[model samples]
Target: MAIKPRSIFEEVSETQKPVAAPGGIDAKGRGARGAIRVWLMMLFALVVVMITVGGLTRLTDSGLSITEWAPLSGSVPPLNAAQWEAEFEAYKQIPEYTEQNAGMSMAEFKVIYWWEWGHRQLGRFIGLVWGLGFAYFLVRRQIPTGWTGRLVFIGALGGLQGAIGWWMVHSGLQEGMLDVASYRLATHLGLAFVILGFIAWYTFSLGRREADLMQARRAGDAGLVTLSGVLVGFALVQILLGALVAGIDAGRNFPNWPLMTTGTGASFFPPDPFSLTPIWRNFFEDAGLVQFVHRMSGYLLMAFAVFVWWRARRSPNTQTRFGFNAMLALMVVQMVIGILTVLYSAPVQIAIVHQLTAVVLWIAILRARFLARYPIAQSIRG
Candidate 1:
């Protein structure tokens, strides 16, 4: 038996191929990967809810009610009359209280107070959801390779957005300032959209296995990929402009749509667009100019969307074509909602609907872009 070992050398006539790298097999197609993605998708939905609530706070003029950022303790609202008075006293110090909402009763104060508190509460909940989910996956070693950094970056952005929320509120507390600065509000909203876009992108990327994604990458369409990027940039600019419109209450000012009007007659540009001090301030503070720019940008966005849809119609992949179709339909509906929002002077219910549609439309565009980058395979049959 011991002498039989010598036969090993005789059997080694053909050298053994090196063992394949460990775990080189496609484990990416496993269920754990999909589970992590589902967690992220849940976080995405929560953030959307947070945004909608924030919009309500602003619409109800409740953004300045909290007066402070208590990341931990502020979760609980006032429980007693004395505590309520303390909160009300802090509010009274702000110009929004002394000048705009002067002499408001306690009951009225409670209404706006609840709206803002709810908004902040939702933000905290979203952060908790993201942190817990990320931490769980990270501890379990369930996060996919190259995704740890992505998840951590999202948490960092969420933290920054919270700080920015306080910063925006602080602006409105300044002497004689009735609301947050338009630029600041735009920054806050822009970053939220950025976070949202990243989530949407990661969600889309995780929908397929690594092997499939790699294979799809080989057949990627560069033209559509480039156009989708352009579309995102184009849409972001329009979104910022819309933020400006919201900040300055410009929508209420231009109640008549398709054309802006003077107090006495009709005009293309807002009359006296340069009236604000320092001329440049007009862009940020001028309602007429901001509203006019927002309207014009909406028009341009619509035109570009039409072009993207036309190109998408030529895509050979059925799923890719459908993605583009959904995006185009949402864009068109968003345009109509934008017009209606202007015509009706941005009533709370209607404006909220417009905003919700905007979130959906944004997600749709992201889906189309994801498809463009890594198109889904399709059958040849009709």
Candidate 2:
């Protein structure tokens, strides 16, 4: 065989294709992004349902029905006749039972007791789902790099939320108290949204590969990001304010729109808006004042959302723009729902619907904010 002549220049001139450093965990199929995202979506749905159920429990004045924070044994509600009477007797000691529902029949007591029991049960279920999913991912060694901490953080928050739930319930159990303190209620609800927000942001991030996210982030709109962030803050504040309103049943007291009246005449503020002693209590306990603050905050939030949507119109990404559009549209719908809720005196059905809309709007705002922070890359034709 004749030996082929090799040019000395060939060795130096030819470029070597470097190995791509084994890609990343994603390329190795270790990220489990899709599986984790599905798990998060499940958590998201459950949390939404939890929020709605919690709202119903509050509205029905059933939150204090159980009068106990039994995380483990409480799961198995009153099973027999004696057990039912025992539970009812315990509830009868609370001011809510003694002062508000004093004449509650066993059947009537059962209804509220079920509401509270179911609410707590749902919380336990959520915690279970989170724990099982987290363990599965951890045991399988499939959690993405840096994500184990995030997942653990969520679990931690869930635990803290349970504690806060008990704290809120304990408030109403105290003497002379008819309902949970408004501030405590707001704190509990606020944490729920915070947990939801983290899940949502993680879910959005996991939908794409980390490399793609890094690349797309380079093209994200800074102005829109800032604006959307501000809008998110406003939306959350409005939501907390709404919680305060619900906490005190303020919406039912102020049925007049465009003006909060004592039902006989139009007035901008509630009657004796600051009648509560110590002055500060008015912000939380005074129906007229709390509802008024919620209303004004909604107006400001709506206006800011409109401004953000207008700013989003200038973004190059179609999906990002669409997200903001949905956000603004939902904000409008939520506002209208709020008005109707007040007009109808916060009836359980209408009030629950209003609360559900707030959830949707919240997710919408978060979706838009995510798009702003990590926009999808698009061709110039887009």
Candidate 3:
């Protein structure tokens, strides 16, 4: 056989070309990420409303108005005068009514009843949204890989929160109790924040592609991540402490700032801070102690947040720095709102704003932490 002359473009060796990643489950799953994020965002808004309604319920002393946790039947409010009276009678049997709201009129009872009913109804709606959304995504095979369990976990928490809400109400129904136990209230509120935190984190993660996140993580600032994580822990503890403050009406007791005092004396501690028998009970029951702890925790949280923000100033990423800056600014705003809430004796409007601000700050800190761990890339001009 005659050999043909070698062409100028002849290959010296076989070189494999890069192949595009195949279309598969993960690719299809990613395609639906935007939709899933929107669903999650809806859940986020509903949960925020739920938390606000829950706060208003507690503030208005309406949590015990239903006096029962009839999850299925409770979705519907009384439609007639007779049914309303029956519902009022049930509430009358609870300790909250006999001890604090004796002789409350039917109209007043209706107001409180509606407050609680609306709270529960919103909860039911949230469950429906999550259930339907999750089911639709599941049936369509749109859920991202490794996300089914996470979504399920949120639903599971929501269900448990419902039970805990009833448990809290049950505490007030017990003989001689004026309100739900502060610790249990703390548990309930704490779990809400945890659920909110997870939803927020998942939302942040879904904002970027999985591969992009992995690559960005390689360039992340580990120290800033750790610092921000500590800040988140501090913020969470402050939140639980705030729940304690709300649980026992502690916020109204200390109307002064820079120093917490009671009606009794010039002492920094409220009267009978440790008067509770078990001593441990003081931490949860004593208004002075609870608010004091909340105040101190707030200070510590702010200090730590400042440090985290300061450290984040050195981050190479512009978005990451801006996130930390916003977090620090919100922390300041929240601090002011909190002081105003206390100074105003926790009025319904200001107190609710304070609580909502905490929610905002919690999410901001989480966003900062996320950025620290998986910073967004910037263009040369940025």
Clashing pairs in 3: none
lDDT of 2: 0.89
Residues 267-307 of candidate 1: C-alpha lDDT, one tens digit per residue: 87789999878989999998899998888888888899999
lDDT of 2 by residue, 1-382 (tens): 9999988777656688887774464575447999999999999999999999999999888898888887889899888999999998998898887888888899998898899999999999999999999999999999988899999999999999999999999999999999999899999998899888889999999999988887788888888988888887887888899999999888888688999878568898778888889999899888899999999898888888888899899887899999999998898899999999999999999999998998888889999988988888788898
Off by over 4 Å in 3: 1-31, 263-265
lDDT of 2 at 209: 91
The local lDDT score (0 to 100) that residue 249 gets in candidate 2 is 85
lDDT of 1 at 353: 92
Stretches of candidate 1 exceeding 4 Å from the true structure: 1-25, 28-31
Question: Tens-digit lDDT track for model 3 on 46-128?
Answer: 99999999999999988888877888987878999899989999988877888899999998998988898999999999999
Q: Is candidate 2 or candidate 3 better by TM-score?
A: 2
Report clashes for each candidate as comma-separated counts.
0, 0, 0
| C-alpha TM-scores of all predictions | 0.93, 0.94, 0.93
